[model samples]
Target: MTFPYDRARLDALVADVDARLATVEETARAASRVRMRSPGLGAADLAAISRFANSPDAPRELKDLARRVDAGELSWRDVASGRAADDEGVQRALRTGVPDLRRAYAAIREGEDPEDVVEAGRPRVVGDDEDGPSRFTEDAW
Candidate 1:
């Protein structure tokens, strides 16, 4: 499948999907920050950030970033580093996964960079404490 790298299309999709995945920051605030912070990043980076920010085993950077967004110390756009993980397999999948989206039974498959592959179309935040800002959730949901 030939993957189209339309920056505007990818950006719009990422922006919308990313906002839906965020539990703490509102859509407008998050979009502004993510856009401003990730000026040079590609759609894959935004996709990864959206996934990373909500993963159970999210990176420290992502966790901190989420908190900053919740606290209004930073915007989601501000956390966008445009720094996609250097995993070609995941990058390729992210670049062209939509073609085989139906067969996407496993995201971040073997040989894929755990950090680079994103669970696209997801709207849940596993890392966000929607109840408050404490970096980690202490209460059972």
Candidate 2:
């Protein structure tokens, strides 16, 4: 899938922070990697992010934050860098409009059900229902 930010914009943003071209591309790839981890985001969901990131109607603050992130002025945990995690720019982006954008694009949290995540590492008997007792279970008596 294509990256949400265009090469030109990414280049320009990185230039503002005096970062290299490879850094911007790496950052964009990291953004894509993060987006891919969202449960409901398919190709269409990614397209929506791309459209919003590139569109004029998108919030200016969000756009600027994204640019700063691309420029390496901000830190995103999903993206590897020497910068501190949870920087103000990253926090603001996550708090202000990023979740709304994800919701608007229908990016569900990971797992079929929220509880599924908690149980992810546990082993379950075959044919056992999640909401019902296991076949091997009986009265403790």
Candidate 3:
């Protein structure tokens, strides 16, 4: 059965999915020092996942689960509580999305060169260092 989409409902779903993705991020980072170089990469991946979750193409099961939450049939936190004792619908949603998110996060974090990502305190050259520069070298007469 289909249910009307609500923004708050979708946001809750997105936040739950994002939290699940966070476990993948933290595990990956802790597993390897190299993966930690791009600090904001996890946030970017989570944003992408949120977009995916809200999109029409997101798994129908996820929508149904969200509908249940919105309808007050289930508490949203139960969805990603990470305990086997949680409701089956919540576990199903977690199982459905975690692997895919893990793969996406891996690709996102591994595919980019860390140096290319913007970071604080990194050095940047403002102008040419050659001595023959025309603009700064010439004095106004």
Rank ordering of all candidates by lDDT, starting from the highest: 3, 2, 1
Candidate 3, residues 67-126, lDDT tens digits: the string is: 776687754444333333367776666667676545544544566542242221133333
Off by over 4 Å in 2: 1-50, 72-85, 98-107, 110-141
List per-prediction Cα lDDT, in the order shown: 0.49, 0.50, 0.56
Q: What are the TM-scores, per candidate, against the unseen true structure?
A: 0.24, 0.31, 0.32
Q: Model 1, range 45-139, lDDT digits (tens) per residue?
A: 54655565567765555565555556766444443332333433324433443343323323433333333333344334455645654353323
Determine which window of 10 residues in candidate 1 has minimal summed lDDT. Answer: 102-111
* Model 1 misplaced regions, further than 4 Å: 1-48, 81-141
Which prediction has more favorable TM-score, 1 or 2? 2
* Cα RMSDs, all models: 22.5, 23.6, 28.3
Backbone atom clashes (below 3 Å) for every candidate? 7, 0, 0
Model 2 TM-score relative to the real fold: 0.31
Q: Assess candidate 1 and give its TM-score to the true structure.
A: 0.24
Better lDDT candidate (1, 3):
3
Best by lDDT: 3
